[model samples]
Target: MIRVLVVDDDPLVCAHLEAVFGFADDIEVVGEAYDGAAALESVLRHRPDVVLLDLRMPGIDGLAAIPRIRAVDPPPAIVALTTFDSDHHIVRALHAGASGFLLKTTPPRELIALVRVAADGHTVLSPTVSRRLIETAADRHVTRGETLARLAALTPRETDIVACLGGGMSNARIAARIHLSEGTVKNHISQILAKLHCTNRTQAGLLAQRAGLRPPRPAG
Candidate 1:
């Protein structure tokens, strides 16, 4: 079963998540927290597979708490919960080590699927949010030659994988696009993360974006 911890300041939201995941046979709602402080305590106590995090809260917001949570041994995949998808908070959350982002109004079915995807080391960017991120990235004209130069350390195949990752493709899709086995794609992703010093593919993408690179389009 995929263990999950739900964190949000709203009691109604917490209860809603608990109730939603309660019926999932493959998922277990292990614990709940009202704020960042409570989240830290609940997470250490439960060690869940994934954490549903709210971007804004009373004390420590989600972005600030990300590094702290990552410092925890066996850090869970953090999927941020937010109301607005177009804000800089989404980018900050991803940069801070969040694996995925879901608008508060996302359908429960879609949210559950994304949670599963994140737990499996894959990302599920909301289509609308993703399009916006792409446009936002493309509209910026800042220079990042120095950062892109770091790609020199990667092998040719790994470079391809990184570009695709920045474009937001699943490992399975990348494998298909690159004509390699999914296992091979997974290994390449691991190598890219290590070499890039990124916590996850989402961060790696942001790094590439800041480095002045546009991720390749999703393979047809």
Candidate 2:
């Protein structure tokens, strides 16, 4: 089962998320926290596979708690929660090691699927968010040359995999497009992350985007 921790200052939101996960046989709600400080504590106690974390809280907000939670041995994947897709906090959270961000208004089914994706060590960016993040990187003036240098360590195959990541393609889709097995794609992703010095796929994807990498065309 994929263990999940729901963290939000609002009790209703936490309960709602718990109920949503209840319907997914593959997912379990392991714990809940009302604030970031408690989130850190709960993460240590429950050791969840994925954490749905609210960005704003009474104390030690999600932004501050993300890096702390991620510092734990074998940290869980963290997906930030926000009311607005354009929230600046999401970008900071991503840089702080969050796997991705999800709008609070996401449908229950999509939320469940995203949690499962996070548990599987994949990113959870919606196309809108992905485009905004790429724009954010561009706004920061992360020149293509700089990103290219960072990706220089990758082999041609790894480059293609990272490009798939840039397009937010899951392992299955990437495998089909690249004519590789899902297991092989997963392995390539791992190597890609290590070579790029990225803690998660979100970072690698952003790097790929900054470098203007495009996914390989589908095979005829």
Candidate 3:
């Protein structure tokens, strides 16, 4: 079972998240906090497997809370909660040890899925805001050498796959581009994620972009 701690200053948001978790048999809301300071206390007491954290919490705030939470022994995975995808706090949260960044307005089902995915050490960063995080990071400059080194560990074929992922291509599109089966692409992605020690594609893509893994062919 996945034990979740919902941390947001708004009680209604906390209630809604707890209600959403109620739909899943495998997840349980173990605790709720209205601020990062309170969240930290709850986290130490509950030791939840995942934390749905609001970025703008009072006191410590989500961005400041991440590393603190991570410092706990066997820290739970953290997913930053924001009202919008492009919120600048997302990157700060991610860099601070958050496993995922999710919008508060995400569909109920998807929000539940995000919790599960984060619990399992996987993420749906393949699309949307997650993709934008990496794309923007690439356009600017983040850690490059680390990403290049990680990508270099892949075989030529896997390197091809990583490039596609970094370019924000879906598994289906990558399969079409490389003439490989989608299942094969999935396997490659799995390997890439494992090798990079990244929880999700957004992290991997940003790393790839930092490494300067550009698409091999011109886009039509």
Model 2 stretches astray by more than 4 angstroms = 126-130, 133-139
Q: Best to worst by TM-score, what's the order?
A: 2, 1, 3
Residue 174's lDDT within candidate 1 is 82
Candidate 1 residue spans exceeding 4 A from truth: 134-142, 209-220
Q: Over the stretch 60-83, how does candidate 1's per-residue lDDT look in tens digits?
A: 988788878988988898888988
Model 2, position 31, has a per-residue lDDT of 95
Cα lDDT, all candidates: 0.80, 0.86, 0.77
Q: Each model's number of backbone clashes? A: 0, 0, 0
- In angstroms, the error of model 3 at 54 is 0.3
Q: Which residue pairs overlap in candidate 2's backbone?
A: none
Please provide TM-scores, in order, for all candidate models, with all chains considered together: 0.88, 0.88, 0.70
Error of 2 at 215 (Å): 1.0
Best by lDDT: 2
Worst 10 residues of 2 by lDDT: 130-139
- Evaluated at residue 78, the lDDT of candidate 1 is 89
User: What is the lDDT for 6 in model 3?
Assistant: 94
